[model samples]
Target: MMAFSSVTEPLRAANRVGGKEPYSWHLISADGEPVSSSSGFALLPDFAITSSPELSHVFVVASIGVRPDRNAPRAIRVEASSRSIPHRPR
Candidate 1:
């Protein structure tokens, strides 16, 4: 939860203080459902992996430690990759 806040708050603050939405964000999830945090807070995602738009940045914020053997996350990545969304420019 803290990590997600740490990353998002800055962008939020920038938009607030700058009086312009220089940074925009969307929460994309594998199922387009609410995701629970490490502390158990649920965050409703804006789009599903398959329904997300072409994103300028994608930040995977996982507060919990995930074992490499976990296949669910990997499956989500695979589903997301099937989209024709172009990669963000470097």
Candidate 2:
């Protein structure tokens, strides 16, 4: 999951309803470091893409105009392709 969206909080809140729903979520970033949102809030990712396991679903969330360049370092491409993750630009 990404840090800039309210999706995480809503999901967490829903889980508190107390059912059989399983909440297995992880926050990740490009450099395995903390990222600052456009709103100036900061969050640390749980893992870096390169070190993460091959996930069935991967979501890359970035604000509009904040998308990473396609010509970014090879490491980013490798990680994206390795997991078949979709690049959701904004």
Candidate 3:
């Protein structure tokens, strides 16, 4: 997604310029499969939440065009939300 890339580009560029990789990131989706953005471009996630490594920060990017299935229960989301993960201060 454009917003996702825009948010991370500066961090990545800084790593490049500094040559020390001070920042790194991962793209994650509800499942491990690739997800499409509002513009229909798909991005493959590095890992699913179930299998992700320890994280320092979490950022959520959403699109107004996408809507959840009202009839179905979101089991994975519910389970992920129940976890008590702590975030590192910036």
Name the best candidate (by lDDT): 1
Superposed Cα deviation of residue 72, candidate 1 (Å): 4.6
Candidate 3 per-residue lDDT, tens place, 1-90, comes to 678878799999999999899899998766678878888887889987667776777777776777674422363455346665543356
TM-score of 3: 0.73
Relative to the true structure, how large is the alpha-carbon lDDT of every model?
A: 0.75, 0.66, 0.73
Candidate 2 Cα deviation (angstroms), residue 42: 1.8
For lDDT, candidate 2 versus 3, the one ahead is 3
User: TM-score order of candidates, best first?
Assistant: 1, 3, 2
lDDT of 2 by residue, 1-90 (tens): 244446667667778876655655677776688777767678788887688765666555677456464533566778777777676685
Q: Kindly provide the TM-score of model 2 when superposed on the true structure, using C-alpha atoms.
A: 0.64
Query: Residue 18, candidate 1: how far off, in angstroms?
Result: 1.3
TM-score: the better of candidates 1 and 3: 1
Lowest summed lDDT window (length 10), candidate 3: 71-80
Model 3 residue pairs with clashes: none
- Give per-residue CA lDDT, model 1, range 35-86, as digits (tens): 7776778899999777778776678777667334364567565765676435
